[model samples]
Structure formats: C-alpha cells, structure tokens
Target: SLSLSLYRAAMKGPGLFSDIGKKGRDLLEKDYNYDQKLTVSTRTASGLGLTTNAVKKGGLYVGDITTQFKYGETTIDVKVDTESKVTSTVTRAELFPCTKAMTTFKNSDLNYGKLEVQYFHDHASVTGAVTLKQPPNVDISGTLGSHGIVFGAEAGFDSVLGTFTKYNAGLSLKKSQTIVSLQLVDKGDMLRASYVHHLDGKQTSAAVGEITRK
Candidate 1:
C-alpha cells in the first residue's frame, strides 16, 4: 500500500512498481533471522614438524535474504542522471519491471579489455559489425544438508535472445556451511569459465576464470 500523497506524486512521472495486482504482491514475502552455535576444534602436528593449533571464525548477518515485501509491478514518472567514463545522460522517461525475481541478475560484472576510443592516425579503413549476445542452454546445480553439500543440477539456456550465443552449465556446493558455485561456458569458437560463491545465502558473485580457444 502507498500513502495517498506518495501515490499522487508518483502518478505525475515515470517509475516502476507503481501498479500491480494484489495476488502478485502477496506471493512474494521475505522472512529471515538466524540461528547460532559454538564449536571448538584443535590440530596436532605429526612426527616430523608436528604442531597443535586451534582456529575459529564466525558471525551473524541481517537482511541476508532478499524478498519482495516492499514493492509490486508498477510505473511512475521521474528523472534520473547517470555518469560513466563511457557515457553520460539525463533520462526523463522509462518503463521498469518490479518482480519477485529478475530474468537475470549479475551481482558483479568486470570487463577488462581494449577500450574503444576515437584516435586519429594514418591507417586503413576499418569496418564494424554490431553484435548481440545470446546465452546458451546450461546446467544448473545446488546443494543441501549442513554443508550445503552438493544439491542438484539445474539446466538453463544462455541465449542473449539470439545474439552472441554461448552454452553453459553450473553447480553449487556448500563449503564449510557456505554455498559456492561455478559455471562453465563455451562459445562456438571460444570457451569461457566462471566461478560463483555465496557469502551468505543470496549474495551471488561470479568471476571469469578462463577463456581459451577451442
């Protein structure tokens, strides 16, 4: 629900999550706290250079789970300003989607490659081609139990919707009660791999591990 004043103001501009059905909002709710315990461990050295030591590392986190308890599918009018080394612009109108989950979410994306900038030089002409990336059908996996262990395999498609398409597969395992996952990708001419790990339960991060020719 929104305050009357808020509703009136939002109606004046463009925004997302302005109007959605009640059923859609109710299905998405967030509930999370935490449980705790204390454990101890020790190590002893063997005959050669044996040593005994103990170690521990633990803590708690709040809002670890992200659920849709605060918004719904809607739109409003607003203004936005964005800046980057690549481009800059002030946006006035936009359509947004507010859903329980995004079609694809990237926690972190790092691109380190040749920067395409304008340079004047005595050189031959160059032709350019526009590109789109189509993700490939992939295998997905998860784990369960105390260790989060190795859950199961889930498969998905990696089509950038008909662009630079690639095939991929992934699995998740629990390491020390923490969930870590990895994805392997393959293009027709090249192969790429990535690893993902969950610090808590929802913060998914990915890293591009290796890319090699086929």
Candidate 2:
C-alpha cells in the first residue's frame, strides 16, 4: 500500500522528471547488458498494545552495468554489484519511524495541497509519504414517506480516521447530540443502524449486546 501511494505521488509531481526517468530506463535497457533480482517477505501480529513476532527479509542482486543519469549538474553511474539478505524480528514498540518533516498547508484559493514526509529511525532506512489529494464535496440524497406527519430526511458529510461513525436521520425519531446504542434494523431493503457516543478519557462502562442477521 505504501509503495502504491508513493507511485501515485511520483506520477502527480515532477511530471517532466518522471518522463525523463522512463526515457532513461528505456535507453538503459536498450544498451545495457545486465540483469537484476529482488525479493521480500514479511509477517506481523499485534496484541496487548504491543507487536509480537514481526519480521521482514529482502535482497537485491545485479550484474555489472555502468549506468548514468542526469541529476542537476552531475552525472552518476549507480551499479548494484552484489547484495545479501537478512531477517529482522523486532517488536512494534521498538520499530519507530524517523519522522523528520511534515508540511501542513492552510486552506487557500490556489489549492496548494498538504505534504508530509517521515524518515525512519534506522540509519540506512527511509520511507517517504505524501497525501496529495482533495475530493470535492458532493452530496445527493432523497427521502419519501406517506403519513401526514412524516417529515424525516437528512444528509451530511462525514469522515472517520481514528474510530467509528454513524448516520441516522428521521422525523419521528428524537435526534440527539450524543446517543450510543446497538441496533438491529430491517427496513425496506436495507439493514443499518447509527450509534453515537462522546466517551471522555479515564472512564469505564459495562454494556453487552448480541448480533443477528437475516
């Protein structure tokens, strides 16, 4: 997933540079006499707020090939002569990222979006990330009821990154600023429920419920 995100970022930014890279790759393949190999594997598990039995292994190999590319005012020949594979099984708590910089952008008419990069704690490790996207706010909804008192319908924008979410709007039902409950509903052809809660810190509660399906 991270690799995919980086792929997208590269495509969106520095379009000319990316095109040059592709052309260079084509040129290299056309003239260079070399082959390469790469492989990676991983497994992970987390429990008790701690990581357990996490591991990763990867390696790379390439034959001799003098490659050069344009980088500012300098030329470089990056050749992977040899490589080795190693495995690491460390706890998640010990695996910390070296988040060096994060550039946040304020709302503006020009639409210069937000960007962030996080380095790794490992001296030889690095990972770059950026969320360069913003979707438009488009809402379309409709509701209908036959009763004379029927007057329930609602729609709104929502986003959840850390926890859970719910959406429920009805005329007869008493709306609330904070309402938490487990519900089982089968109305028309849909089955859904919306619960609400504002749980403050350092608080405990005891509640139980059963789940059923049709």
Candidate 3:
C-alpha cells in the first residue's frame, strides 16, 4: 500500500520516491456493494528543486488529468478533463538570493497574472502582492513569532483609492500536544477559533466561528 526509495544523482541532486507523494483511493458505500468514487494521483520531488504531480479521477473511469511540474524556481501546471472537454494551464516563477527576500510571478492561460514579494528576518516575515491585470488589487501581510506564539496581520488595498479596504489578524499558539488559533476578519466582521490536540500520534481538532455582517 505504501512504498519509498532514495537514490543519489550525478548532477540533478538526490532523488526520492514514495507512495506518500502519489496515491490512489477508492470510496464505497457502507455495504461495499457499489462503486462510489475513485482517485489516482502522483507527486514527486527532488533535492534539485524538481517536483511533479498528476491526478485523475472519476466514479469508475478516469475522466480528467491534471499535472504540475516545478524545476528550480519555475513551475507549470496543466489540467485536462475529458468529460468537460476543458483544458487549462498556469506558469509561475520565483527567485530568492542569499538575502532574506523573495519575489514571484505567475500567469495563466486565462490572462490572469500576479506578482508577489516577501522579506524575512529572524522570527518575522512580511509580504506584499498585487494583481498585474485589470481590476487590479493589492495586499500586504506580516507575521512575527517567537517561543510558542505567532501573530499575523493582513490588509487589502483598493487599487484606485490606494486605501486599505479589508483587514485581518490572527494568532496561533502551540504547546506540547495542543495547538490553538484565533482569527478576525473585517469584511464580514468574523471571528474564528480552533483547537487541535494530538494524542498518540493522532490528531483531533475543533473549530468555532461567528460572522456579524449580513
């Protein structure tokens, strides 16, 4: 049901193989009398920053194929569905030097585009992103953490007004077997909290939230 392997490469870096990266699952009714669903997927990664994933699924026959590939700082994704007769593709690239800064660019067949930049220091990171096409949008986020606690905040800015239009903040804490998180969002005036507990290598989680805006 599961398999894994590791091998050395001459110039492409180390390679790893595992069913953990690619998997297939089938779900049936409680009585196991009829086929309910099926899925097949595969993913691979190497030390040289090469990664790939492919998936196909349907009730009884494979109907679609989706694949993703990443080499070094560039990525490409594609999807094809036989049932719907639809195909889509997207490409992305990222760059980061020895410094604590990174930048990314993304584009899709639908003419969608985005750019992102991030900077990190010690236990903190800041990020900014913008849409590159019409109906432009921008967002900024920052996170700081130390010990067992992490705090983060994000805001969205209106492209035309150049003013913040949305804001959110969150906090997370972890200790031993328990983890807790809280988040607040401005648009819907929402507040959410979640708790997770780990027991004997298993995890159980619960979440509660509320929205005040109609």
Candidate 4:
C-alpha cells in the first residue's frame, strides 16, 4: 500500500520507453559532469523556443543550436551545427489515447532517419523504431508494472543481416526512499546492479552505488 502511494506520487505524466530503467541509470550516471558547459535558452510566447549549448573540455569546444516549436498535440525540434549537419524530429502525442508517433530526419544522410512510435499506459509501456534505409534496422522495447516495480526488455534487429544486434533486460524496484535495480545488457554479456538511497525527504541528497560484471 505504501509503495503504491509512492508510485502514484512519483508518476507525473506518461512514461517514455527509456524510462523503464532510467531511475537506476540516472542514479549511477547523472550530474557528474567534469567539463565546462554553458547553455542559453529562451522561449517565445508563440510556443517556440531556442537553445544553444557549448561544452569545452581539454581545449576542445563543441556546440549546437536547437529550435523547437509546439502546436496543439505536435512538437517539432530542429538542430543545427557548425559541421553542416542538420537534424530534425517531429513528435505527435495522443495519436490514440496514450500513443505517440515520432519521426526523425538527418540532412546529411537520409538513410540515417528513423520512425518511432510509443504507447504509454498506467501499468505498461511499449516503443518501436525502424530506420529509413532499405534493409532497415528495427528496435522494440517494452516495460510492465508500475513505478514501484517494473520489468523491461529491449531488442534490436538488423534486417539486412537477419540477426539480432542487441538485447537487454532490466528490473527495478522503488520504495519510499530507496531504489534497487539489476540489468543484463550487451546481449547478456554484461550485468549491472545499482542501489540508491535518499538521505533527506527533499531528495536533494542521495547515496548511490553500482557494480558491474562481465
């Protein structure tokens, strides 16, 4: 009962496909940036936003500019870079109830584009993507259960090679102030486990640990 309440409180909106094991991943990998980065963002009254980010590390500078427009149930994002590469993504939500459709394009290589669709439900989520090339690669992932405890798996198929390129499965459990997760990735070639504990009620401070085996 307590877990259910906590799960409901933590769930703010529709879950994304990658949210399956995101908690553990974030606990182990987030907010540890060692590089210098700067970002400036602005939003207009007409549902348009522009953002530019630059990162400098070890005398290397990298930057990109992105623009986003939102209208009704659709959102479009475009990114431009100094390297003459342009990328765009269009997302439409509520295509049906809790379903969303997304398409991505790359100006440099049309074959690098992809189409993705996602469905999110209270107790489950599913996502599928396919590349635009003739012998496209496809990826599918699904998760089941609520935020308190969930099991998820993902697989990638290479149509040209007629083989599975990748597969991974993970499970995560969240309680009031603790999270534990286990993942088998790289087609079961590697295993990882993580634990996170909030030190305060505000969740601003936490202790996290992770272990991996290959």
* Candidate number with greatest lDDT: 4
Model 4 is weakest, by summed lDDT over 10 consecutive residues, at 1-10
For each candidate, give its TM-score against the true structure.
0.22, 0.17, 0.57, 0.81
Ranking by lDDT: 4, 3, 2, 1
TM-score quality measure for candidate 4: 0.81
Q: What lDDT tens digits, residue by residue, belong to model 4 across residues 80-185?
A: 9868688887777665554555666777774455666555567876777777657778999888877488888999999989999999998888899998878899
Name the weakest run of 10 consecutive residues (lDDT summed) in model 3. Answer: 16-25
Q: Kindly provide the TM-score of model 2 when superposed on the true structure, using C-alpha atoms.
A: 0.17
lDDT of 1 by residue, 1-214 (tens): 0111111112211111111111122222222213442323333342111122222225532212111211124222121112111211111221232111112122222221111111111211111112122222322222222223322222233444534343333334434423334434343334323233334545443221222345
Evaluated at residue 68, the lDDT of candidate 1 is 20
> How many clashes does each candidate structure show, in the order listed?
32, 1, 0, 0
Error of 4 at 50 (Å): 1.7
Candidate 2 wrongly placed segments (more than 4 Å): 1-135, 139-189, 193-203, 210-214
By descending TM-score, how would the candidates be arranged?
4, 3, 1, 2
Please give the CA lDDT of all the candidate structures: 0.25, 0.26, 0.49, 0.75
The per-prediction CA RMSD against the true structure, in angstroms, equals 22.6, 22.1, 11.2, 7.0
- Residue clash pairs of candidate 4: none
For model 3, what is the error of residue 66's alpha carbon versus the real structure, in angstroms, after optimal superposition?
Answer: 1.9
